[model samples]
Target: MDFSVRTVRADEWERARDIRLAALQDPAAPIAFLETYEGASAQPDSFWRERTEGGSESGGGRVRQFVAETSDGRWVGTVSVLVERPSDEVRFGAPAKVDQTHLVGVFVRPEARGTGVIDALFRAAVDWSWTLPEPAIQRVRLYVHEDNARAAAFYRRFGFVATGETVAMPGDESAFEIEYELPRPEAGA
Candidate 1:
């Protein structure tokens, strides 16, 4: 509750990389993220810089990353949204059937959990998605590992309903990830 949520800046790549590395080490990382801590940490500084730059405010309208920073300037949470157009190639499970934004790389420090940081981060991400100009985004979606009950619960509480779509988790065809989405709200409602 003491933190403020806002889009990330290109210059803050180092901070972004640090928080992400922390997230990848969380116990839930296996189910919550497609990449492993080892894989991410092994990435060079250049990779982190490019990745952060691509999602920063100056990173063209294709993607945006929001972070929750405390009054002291520590970033405790983050959520990135990737704008997907019907004509664009798919990045994960499926191709975009409509103008939509895929929410990814969601994370909140363990100490920051249950303190409203996640909610604030999500609100910022979703609000930004809805505000995109031209071929407006029609929906916001995310995939959760089938066994990630905690994440699914939060997504449901946040108004994202399960779309009943499932795809094999990458690198592990035996496991599945379910899709959940929040359709654009009606005007004034």
Candidate 2:
């Protein structure tokens, strides 16, 4: 794909914010993202700073953000993974049963959608989950809106089997989030 997948730097908060806002403006944003572009764009610079740092290595927040940079040095895609410890509160429901990496905030620029950037970004996120040291991740998971068939298909193709887990959408009736997981590699196999 000729794209460079790498962790985002904490200092690149501005760039991060730009891409995220752009993603929110995409046609599928209503079902693909929880936050609106208007909301994100209105957030203070401090918000972006904290969010960027929280997902960067230097922040030590147990979360990582990976960006797919094109040959021209533009960030065309991004995916963030948040490590969830067993004791931590479940992101939107029950506490995690085992240590895991919860993938979120995935987005690819409209122009880069079909150029293999999504696969590359996903690989980077999944690989990072297994590479963590403290608490050692056991699995990687992501949630997709029930109606996002296009994304659901891609998740299936990427080896994230549906765990049959479902979470009701917050403050919304007749909507649910379907969970999919990527199993970790076994030791000494």
How high is each candidate's TM-score?
A: 0.98, 0.95
lDDT of all the models against the reference?
A: 0.93, 0.88
Model 1 stretches astray by more than 4 angstroms: none
- 17-106 per-residue lDDT for model 2 (tens digits): 988998899898888888999899999999999999987889795889999997888999999998899988767644688889898999
User: Per the 3 Å backbone cut-off, how many clashing residue pairs does candidate 1 have?
Assistant: 0
The best candidate in terms of lDDT: 1
Residue pairs with colliding backbones in model 1 are: none
Q: What is the TM-score of candidate 1?
A: 0.98
Q: Pick the candidate with the highest TM-score.
A: 1
Number of clashes recorded per candidate = 0, 0
The TM-score, computed over Cα atoms with residue i paired to residue i, of candidate 2 is: 0.95
- Go through the candidates in order and give the C-alpha RMSD of each one to the true structure: 0.8, 1.3
Tell me how far the alpha carbon of residue 39 in candidate 1 is from the true structure, in angstroms, after superposition: 1.1
